[model samples]
Target: MGVVVSLEDSKNRQASVKPLVDLTKGDMERVNQLILSKAGSDVQMIPEVANHLISSGGKRLRPMLTLASAAMFGYAGDSHIKLATSVEFMHTATLLHDDVVDESDLRRGKSTARTIWGNQASVLVGDFLLGQAFRMMVDVGSLDALDVLSTAASVIAEGEVLQLSVAKNMETTEDDYLQVIRAKTAALFAAAAEVGPIIAGASRAERNALKSYGMNLGLAFQLVDDVLDYGGSAAELGKNVGDDFREGKITLPVILSYRRGTPDERQFWRTAIEGGENGDENLEKALALITRYNGLGDTIARAQHYGTIARDALAPMPASALKSALLEVIDFCIERLN
Candidate 1:
């Protein structure tokens, strides 16, 4: 069984996200329109597969970061909408590719694009989305923003490749895992937050601050996700529990448990993980071992560490509703582990 959060903690998480959602509602409506407009193609399969995932109930958090970050600096222009749309496209594109790579059946509790449309269609449509995202970035006409997002795209690719290299390898280090998440996940987040301030014409200091905030928050978000794989319900995760373990993906909890465990436990990890012998019985064992070795708790601790850094990143900025919401987002990310 996965770790369950208390009702109070769950409510707190909802409260943190609700404000950000409310604040960005109007901008997100515009972004949703742009996403729909840009996702269209004459090719029937392209739109079919693209919309399958795009219209799925993702919170659109990355793009919301773009909108809210710009709103924080009092941006009144339409470019933030374009940039936010681009961010969503980029995120959606990555999900398509990730589903194919992970061979996942479900995403957000719906059939994965690759599962419905086949891997080739999913990959091709993902490429189309990336092209559209780049075009929108060009339309935004800010070289700095373009450079940041474009670099993030490249880094995300590199992160996926790195994850491939480390997959099913029990020898993978915590540093190696962090590098993968930083590139694969945090890079886009940093770009999303940074572009908002960039388009708003905020100071370099402010831009860097949001970037730091996003980066650390991304790290914390991913760490909690790792913990959730062992501790959260399917409803909460939108995928099966122990999905990471079943996939043999080396996450922080697995890394910590594998390292801290006894020699016999290490061998057990090798058998289940590297040996690809994961079954329900083995998954139960894996969860027990994780708990015995304090893997989940320690991973949450690490997330909290990053969450603190994320909070401090915003300290110099003046207080506002947006800033408070952003800070609460950090707390929500960590509190999911409860």
Candidate 2:
């Protein structure tokens, strides 16, 4: 393990965004087109829901990672695009289902599928997308690809279940939180990055390096996201600032702040975490306590620690523009806050 770096250690810069942009040139347009084209059906309802969500516009970070990983290994084939599209479909399906499960009102600054199409339609369509993604994998014709993606899908479901199980449980430890994140957030990222090497026929060591890079990067990304839920404005994050607390979802910073709170402060957390009375009031108190205890700073340090690990994973690969872009991706994970 390395000493974690604080947010105050460096100012945010544009250099961090360079790598992701470089590796994912034209990916947004291509990904959306692929998603819409593949979601084709005679039934208008499936296409309508699929097109709505697919075109809603996310950062396309998952597919970018797949392409970036392949580029890093000097892979020149077009097959990475198919694989990347498959990964994006899987990720989108998860989000659609997640909003339904979480009863969320907003996602990516717009109405969620569940909100528009109803939970039944959203859930079934999500399942359809999952099967569509697998159909893509079959087209790619690689058992290695299938193995990594299939395992990742299983882990993602498990992670969702783990988080649901721990909800409203104030006794949840940091280790338990990390486990959920590894499964829910990082699993898809790791699979997306690793699929490149499998498709490119890279050696095991190279494959592992890409996997590590994605895992660490994904962890850093999600840790920052959790922090932003409390620290960022709704406009900046494009979602409710206190939505996590309101939903009784205990994240790392809130859990850490609670652990370090006085008896009275702990009582406040117990109410908030357990969905007791004065929910909004308790959210305010919890936010204030987190700030008082430097929970935000601690959270940033943890994200930076994983960002460093993501960078380390790139060391064994041959130097290229893709390599530089990979480093930038780690920095982007940290810099996005600013």
Candidate 3:
């Protein structure tokens, strides 16, 4: 299908189904088993903390991406299961650290690792999980595997640093926002897709294709996440609405609102986010400003644009159910808000 048509299909599918693909049927069970096993036996305290988040039941999108990418390339070995589990371990480690850094109390509607275990314990266990992830990758026995994950780890740290530097700063540009998202989120997704072909010894073209697909999908996923923080129900989104604004983190919708708001709306932001505190009363005004400026529409459009790019990236791959599932995933990314 053409890129535009594929994008439309993704949109349509997203409206009907929350997820573009379901991983439960194939190697997903094996991958999950490996992930639990890799959490390690000794160091009961650390492993317990890691298990807390692991068992909380996230969407497990990263590992699913890894398996899907390998499947797309026609890999049948069990190594993909190990690698996918490793990807999930790395992802979980980051979240543990992220909650500590953000001083967050809630994740997936439960108390976060840091909240339950204290910051020091959460940080230490996060370190432990990161170590386990590398050890697992070493067991996988691919230098290419090391290259993808090590680079992604560095990028994730950079993204965290970038986010820390920009917090509560009104001078952040759209480019700044994109940099943070690429580092914090898109880098891992790209690695998840790229590693499959790297592991399976697929052609360079195929590797690049999967990489682009992953990057675009990651971007779309994050945009929707940011948008949902402003527009979603707390129950539906599994966190407090306006948490981004409350944390003084300006995401795409807020940035768009700041850029396009009327003079009064601009002044409201200057006081609420820049000069004054973001009070509960200001939330209505904030939402109104974004609505008036069409910030939500602009943000959603950007997400859809990335979803289109991701779907188009699948064209070079041979037709398979796995490839089709990946396309559906791109659709799910864009339609998640609805």
Candidate 4:
């Protein structure tokens, strides 16, 4: 169901993200400055909580996407900087809210903002970030760009609600899960990329191309993140491995394992996920079941499927370092499994 790259391809993938990072370096610096400025407020705790996660070493990939997508059309303006910062703020706001909703303790290998500031502070600060993001979008003065980003915000909230409805429910279908991720994860990515072309006044074909690339890339990124929850080290994930299992989150691995498992295996899952029997022993058993059913492998394969689509989405664009780097980002996302 997915294209498997050669070992040679995989080995080369390690450096894939570097070029994009290099390409966006200057713009990203401006975006970071804007982030820090906007994240601040007279309320000491607002900046305190926002900076806790912002200063935590995230890749800032979403903002970088905005920069790169703009650069692809040779855009030379300050609006991309504002838009990129807005994208980052939106992303950060979502993370703060997600940690609270998931009741998580750690993010990026540090205590979550919610853990330090309490859920109310975390939620309120998240709202503040969102308000700042929309203000920046308005400052950009582009109705189309504003429309795309605002719609993504609405879709992301819907996705969160959908995920909550399915949480710990083993009966969640693959289609249902895909819909959730598309809205929650991919919507922002699509908006980030689409706005670039909108600001640049690129053709409809180019706009659609970047949107497709971002959407598929986001899907691949999140799918790989799900796989890492079960297989990666806490150091690699920046949080404890098996947190999904502990939280009774019905990720793709659990859905696959549950549907394919034996009767006894199914009961084990029900007890562990539905009954909330998520002790250390149960987590190990869940891992065993996921591996036994090749859930992780299948999930990686699904990621590869989306990764290919993301790469192909860039094929029609003219050759440039930015385009090449974007293609390599797809490979990097998939190769993270290794």
**All candidates' lDDT scores?**
0.90, 0.83, 0.80, 0.90
Q: How many clashes would you count in candidate 2? A: 1
What TM-score does each of the candidates earn?
0.97, 0.94, 0.92, 0.96
Error of 2 at 299 (Å): 0.8
lDDT of 4 by residue, 306-334 (tens): 98899889999999999998888888776
Of candidate 2, the 10-residue stretch with the lowest lDDT total is 1-10
Worst 10 residues of 1 by lDDT: 5-14
| TM-score order of candidates, top first | 1, 4, 2, 3
> How close to the true structure is residue 296 of candidate 2, measured as C-alpha lDDT?
79
lDDT of 3 by residue, 1-338 (tens): 00011123422234422232454346888877777787867878877898899999687888888888887777877778877787888899899988988888788778898877899999888888888888878888999878988999999999999999988676688999999999999999999888888888899898899999988889999998877777776764667777777777778988888887667777778788776577777877888777777777788889989989998898877877677777777766766643
True-vs-predicted CA distance for residue 186, candidate 3, Å: 0.5
RMSD over all Cα atoms, model 2: 3.6
Better of 1 and 2 by TM-score: 1
How do the residues 282-304 of candidate 1 rate in per-residue lDDT, one tens digit apiece?
A: 99999988988888888888988
Where is model 4 more than 4 Å wrong at Cα?
1-13
**Better model by TM-score: candidate 1 vs candidate 4:** 1
Residue-pair clashes per candidate: 3, 1, 0, 0
Cα TM-score of candidate 2? 0.94
